[model samples]
Target: MRKSDEAGTRPDVVRIWIALGLVIILIIAAAMMLVEADTQRDQQEQVASVISKLSTVRARLEGAINGNLLAITGLIVEISMNPEITQEEFSRYASVILAQKTEIRHVSAARNLVISHIYPLAGNKKALGLDYRQVKKQADAALRARDIGGIFVAGPINLGQGGRGFVARTPIYEFSESGVANQGRFWGLLSVVIDVDKLYGVAGLTSSNQTIEIAIRGQDSSGSDGAVFFGRPALFDSDRALLDVSLPHGSWQLAAA
Candidate 1:
């Protein structure tokens, strides 16, 4: 009878051990699911933060560009009214504008497709007498600005003066003797060189950002159809936040991850 009881107790103990093993397995699976859920939540929050930063940068960049462009309008008006503006007069006026807006590298005027007047001619003397028709890269945009009778931005391209910058070009039509702008008489092109690094720094897009990686494409404001001008090209292919930078003639695509 005692031997029979021991056999029965052995089976009961085996059953209890099996049940404990199953419970342990379930607990581990649940813990893993919770960890995965937490990880996903964290990733979503991180992505949200990056997107917010990108939006803020976009606004700042646009504001900086538009502000400087608005300032250029006054100079354009002056040039339109006086198509015979001399280098000395142009330099003096440009000096005042530059003094107010430090981000502007230089201001130039092209009369009959020939670059004639450039302000702060110290470093930019090389660009003087540059013929827009001769330069293939810039010729198209310059012509487009004239034909469209509006402002067209080009580059982040290699400049004759040195370095790379965005050139905002607007067709300057001469004012009639009656003090009215005559679209029929296209006097020249007015261009302003924006310091790329300074502009980016003002927009908080310099290399100082450790958490977010940013890339800008759409050279010449061609939007996604254009090449990458800032940051890595691969960034656009990745799962990144994208925004369109509204420019004068076209748009730039901004990506952040």
Candidate 2:
């Protein structure tokens, strides 16, 4: 009888040990699962934070681009309204624009699509006789009705001059037959060549411990080369590729990584 009772007690002891081992294993597994979940959540939050920062930076840059375009356009329109502006008058205005060294690159005027005035930088002897209308896209843009009152951003082209730059043109209109018309017919195009390097620097992008990239692309539906205006890569081996985006007219898309 005693032996039987001892045997029964031994079996109960073994069963208790097995049950305890299973409970410990379950606890460890639960802890590991909780830790993994927390880590994943943290990573997702970090990615979201980076995306938000990029969006804010892009918005600020777009505002700057628009503001600069408007400033140049306004200056051109003001000069055009003065019907009797002489070469001396233009030189004086050019000097003023050049004085704004940080922002203004160069101010120029074209009469009947011929280079008339190029500011600050001299030796424009060759530029004088060149017909701007030869650049088909620009000539077409100059004729657009919307170009009269305001300015339009033009060209990612090599301006056939010393530097590669873009143009901001505001059309000059002759006063209409009706006295009430504030603007005249399209007589000429006033443009400014923006220094690409200077424009990018103003965007306020900088590298960090992690890799970073910045780029600007235009929105075009026709699937033409969406112009990439600028980019800065943080890594030496980073691929500099244009990112596609849907952007509104008169607006540009900025992307960062």
Candidate 3:
């Protein structure tokens, strides 16, 4: 009851204060842990959402790329039937199909590795005479495309037509005049240039409300491996959602955060 006793450091009194302080500290710690648990849960949920979004975008974008591949298939077939496929005919077929695929900037055909026909050449005359094999940057890709004997893709390179994009190339093997089924020889290539920014925009990474960042790294269209054709390469190494894009002729790694 005395002031001295009230202020005294009695063993029991010290024990009482220590117990009370311990209770308060425990309560604060539990509350903080609960808040942290909620925060971690929310963060995990956001990650799940982003992963789901990435799956949807991957499917959609792959479909677009496949559609481009198919469009060129028709041209490839026609050219196979007649390696001398007319410029007028090629332009007609390509203009219509390329018009349907907004991601594709241009469609072209080459004979013996020479640019023989190109659709929408109005803005691409510079490409008409440009030989892929003649250029250092394009030669390896061109040769690889020819030897790989499949649909190849190259670039994230600047176009002679005046833009940055990717080119998808497929070797065209045509039958000889002898009309032998097995005697078909490698004729040339069918190339399509895809607008990178526009393609990613379609992939939903460029939307005004887009939040998830994405990147890709894989074999380029020219049969070169371990190249980051889209987005940042480091993102592939970072913690992100990874999806595999199965192309008609190849595969690529897709990463999203």
Candidate 1 minimal-lDDT segment of 10 residues: 175-184
Give stretches of model 2 more than 4 Å off: 1-40, 136-150, 159-163, 175-183, 206-211, 219-225, 232-248
Clashing pairs in 2: 173-184, 174-184, 174-185, 175-184
**Model 2, span 66-174: residue lDDT tens:** 6665556445655557655666777777776656645556777777767676665465546665575686755655554244455666545565555556566666765
- RMSD in angstroms, all models? 3.5, 5.7, 4.4
Candidate ranking (lDDT, best to worst): 1, 3, 2
TM of each candidate vs. truth: 0.83, 0.66, 0.78
What is the per-residue lDDT of model 3 for residues 77-167, given as tens digits with 9 covering 90 to 100?
7889987788899999998887889999988888888888988878876677778789898887778778877777776788766768877
Worst 10 residues of 3 by lDDT: 217-226
| Candidate 3 residue spans exceeding 4 A from truth | 1-11, 176-183, 213-237, 241-257
Alpha carbon lDDT of residue 181, candidate 3? Answer: 41
> Could you tell me the lDDT of residue 118 within candidate 3?
88
Better of 1 and 3 by lDDT: 1
Of the pair 2 and 3, which is ahead by lDDT?
Answer: 3
